[model samples]
Target: MIKSMDEFTLTINGKQIETKETIGVINPATEEIVGHAPVASKNDLDLAVKAARSAFPKWASRSFEERSELILQFANAISENQKELASLLTLEQGKPLSFAEREINMAVYWLKESANHRLSTEVLEESETTYIEKHYTPLGVVGAIVPWNFPVLLAMFKIPLALLSGNTLIVKPSPYTPLTTLKIGEIASTIFPDGVYNTLSGDDALGPMITGHPGIDKVSFTGSTATGKKIMESAAKNLKRVTLELGGNDAAIILPDVSIDEVIQPIFWGMFLNSGQVCINAKRIFVHHDIYDKFVDKLIEYAKTVRVGNGLEPASQLGPVQNLVQYKKVKNLIKEAKQNGLKFAFEGEAPRSGYFIPVTIVDNPPENARVVTEEAFGPIVPLLKYQSYEEVIERANRSQYGLGGSIWGKDIELAKSIADKLETGTVWINEIGALSPTIPFGGHKQSGYGIEGSVEGLKEYTNTKIIRINKR
Candidate 1:
């Protein structure tokens, strides 16, 4: 069992590896140093990759049942220490305690659910003249780069899929919130064999090293589209398989048929959950002109009830932005929107200190405004008015991002029809930010490619091979 510590080390080849330099992890709520994390060098990354490469053959040779059982054990281990990890996660990631615990619980659930999936061999043809079958074979050494937001859950999902498909892995969590994940690595060290699962923590340099390393056969990354593009370019040098889950400026359309009383709370949370740091959070909203004013008023009423404070406090409903860089970016976007003469529908308050950005609502900002056009990974949401369903669909589809969008209305068929026309990877009618481990989730267009869940996601860690038998 790993205890909570102010100083954390890297796990490579089932051993704790210390680096020459160390970085400080910050608590977003108080702007205080939460912990110190060892920073890995290029050589350290190489050693981790080498370890994973060496462990691949033996790990891959294990039976599917054995791997599944091990994964379930891993999930149980996570559940056992859920409280401790959730506390540490809130310190670094700045989400409320409830959301942090939810993330941990979801991580355990995803691991167990993923364990239930199997990569069975498929029979393509059976006849007297010929027989054909397709098999899923493990790709050696996968490098999984997890983002700061939802680090544990994101990394947990990748673990079972990659390992169950028989690939050894190296996880590189974002430098901003690597503590809980590194702690997870500590737990993994005790269960899995040396080199089968490893974690390396460092500054920005480690990511390129993982993606470019020759020993690594695949890269599974979740982050910004800009960073995802760089990863793709780096992985291309070795022609390694890459799964990139990048940025999203998700939109939600509210039709006039919705009950203002019933839908306000769900829609408010949809936009403000995780303080709008989620990649699939509702950033842009389109409300029908008939009910736009009432919706906005009710949404403001619901927003006022939220209490933003330290995650450790029991009363805090929202926490600070995860890191300094993202905090500034979100603040700048809000300033830019105001400078452009956009009306503020409702701008809530925040404390004088810490990386806190109040939940702000922009009223009918133009299509090209920064708040509506770019991805605001914070609590700033822009609400736009649409006179017709076709107009809303056209506006929603115009953006370069096509990660996710939602339609809220009483007419299920009407909402479904509008959902079909929106250009996005996922669409929810009267629902937002709902993800299931059994469902496939990915993006389209500039948001990036590759699936992250379901059978399709499991196959991302493997290569397909066909076997054909001929009779003369």
Candidate 2:
């Protein structure tokens, strides 16, 4: 049994409030209770919004350079404490320690990058006896909903950018991975004034409260498509601005010319990284007929070598699926696929415990299989073969979700050509899931809308104002 800690209370509007209801933070590897986080009630959400609203004017009035310098300090603090944060993340979230460390490093990168983003004066066209100018202003209190998969990194993407853009934030992290995010809030409170930034933890109920609150000017959410829709509906009541980064059933297309080994290596990383919990993971793979058999064999051979165990162990390449709910979902999906006549191949011995599902490959999986149609969000890859480029492109774009996809081949020109046909926000040619802070990330279709990261992300939290002057 996991020992319960005191409710993780946070201060909002310079007042501390503790909730009676607390959530158990579990370590999936051992099924032990790792920690406890407060389950914020509707009252807590109101306090958070009030804090953000109260702090907005002061934060927005500060010069960009001032905000930037403080954010840089926050970044430095994160770097100094990276190891501690990484360990906490692994304990609460169940990803490999290496992955956790990498996520912390990425968070630091985003902070520094966001701080460096230019937020100064811009010139508009001038004419005789007339002047015109454009300015960027903060969007008041922002409500951010982050996912558990990459808690710190994803939170930083919005927090620093929102702050630098002159907005105050009320951030609600996913219940599954609230530790790192709460730690971030702890660190920010030291430098940021009270109410400038606040962290809230709870179930889905808090989300609607935050997004629908009159005090919140905007909502930035990263999670499932269904939840994103719910957020949109709630935000519409108050007309709160929204930016959503939702579900993805990304595709990986292997063209005829590429050597299977070269392409498979990167695909393996995309499909299996963080135990395939990533939104942009290449869950569906389409290979040209000529290399289908060869690719499948090589993929299984390489997968068999993957090491799975407790994430804290250095030798473990894959960690347990984050929670029991996700574990059961993946297991049932695999069983259903098998019942539907899909062939399953595993690289190594499956774990005796129900939590550890091996790197599983299903060959010639039909489009109707849950593994192909839904976001498996686990270490399972369904392989399909296509005779020509046209047929494959059609199959790839048939899904309702279109967040991201990739094409792998030696002929860069051919791959690029095929990449254009796929209806995703971002397409990787010859690689998969290679995201950078400089690139804009989001989705199309049912995958959800609006962009995150890059210049677009900074713009998401700002209101553009135009000033016009006429002199006679």
Candidate 3:
């Protein structure tokens, strides 16, 4: 058992392996050391890969029903410890307690539903003279590297699917927010077989090691586009399978027919969830000139009501940026906008002590401005005005990153048409970030590739083989 959740250790081969070196986990709210996480080296990562490689065959041999049962147990275990995990998530990742709780709940839901899926051979052809079939088989061991933004949930996106598809795994949680994931690893140590599911925590060194490790058959990663490119390049060395869910400058286009009242709340939450750190959050907004000013006014009004503070507090609606690096990066974006003379629509106040940034909205920033083109990954968002549907659609699809986007309007047909034209992998009609376990989620262009949910996603953890026979 783990000695303490705060001082978390690495889980390798179903054992809590304490490291000689450790890193301090800071609370973004107060910038205080909440705990220490084991800093894994190349050797530690190698050991994890070796363990997973050895366990893959046996784990893969298990029946789908048996695997599903164990996955369900793991999900239930997470549910039982939901509160503790949620609090830990909030403390480490700096999202509010409420959002943290929701993340845990959604993670559990994903795990349970993922286990319910199955893979079977497809009968391609059958005749007196010939027979052919296509089978989906496990891809030895998966190295799942999860990000700080929605760490637990993103890890869940990898875990259940990889395991259920008969792949052993070594999870590398972001060093910035490794506590809750390590705690989950502790729970996993009890449920999974030795070497079947393992987790290691470390800084920059671990990622390259995981991607380049020959023993790791596949790598599933979720993070920035720039990092995703590097991971793809590294994985290519051994030609290991890779699934990347990268950065997204997702946009939400509000048509002239949209009800200002109807969309205000959804757009507000979409832009500011987790203080707008979401990969697919509405980073850019394209509003019709007919309702652009009104939309901005209502959105600013709603932004004022959100309370920003320490995530653990009962009343804090949004919390600080997850780490010092990201905090500085976001602050720089805000500063650049100010330097560029962008019009400010709304700027909420924040406490002085933490890695906090106010809810900053830039009004009608130029298409060429950084605030309009870049993925802020913070509370700062740009509301761009457009004169025509053609112009707005063109502007919305302008970015290099396209993970998800949404079209908001009263006319369902109009919204559907706009959503169809979106360059994103997932486009919501009259909604934002409405993700379901059964639906496949991925990205187009620089946002990264490979499906993350549904049977399509589950298959990414496996390899396809063809079987053919001849009858005499």
List where candidate 2 sits over 4 angstroms from the true fold: 1-7, 14-17
- Clash-forming residue pairs, model 1: none
Model 1 lDDT on a 0 to 1 scale: 0.90
Candidate 3 pairs with clashing backbones: none
What lDDT does each candidate get? 0.90, 0.83, 0.91
Model 3 over residues 1-472: C-alpha lDDT tens digits? 3346667889999999999999999999999999999999889988988999899889999999999999999999999999899999999999989999999999999999999999998999999988999999999999999999899999988999999999999999999999999999999999999999999999899899889989999999999999999999999998999999999999888888888897799889899998899998999988888888889889988888989999988999999988899889989988888998888988998889999999999999889998888888888999988898778788888889889998888899988887888899999888889887689999999998899999999999999999999986
Q: Provide C-alpha RMSD values for all models, in order.
A: 0.9, 2.6, 1.0
lDDT of 1 by residue, 98-199 (tens): 999999999999999999888899999999999999999999999889999899998975888999999999998999999999999999998889999999
Q: Please tell me which model should have the higher TM-score, number 2 or number 3.
A: 3
Task: Report residue 372 deviation for candidate 3 (angstroms).
Answer: 0.7
Q: TM per model?
A: 0.99, 0.96, 0.99
| Model 1 misplaced regions, further than 4 Å | none
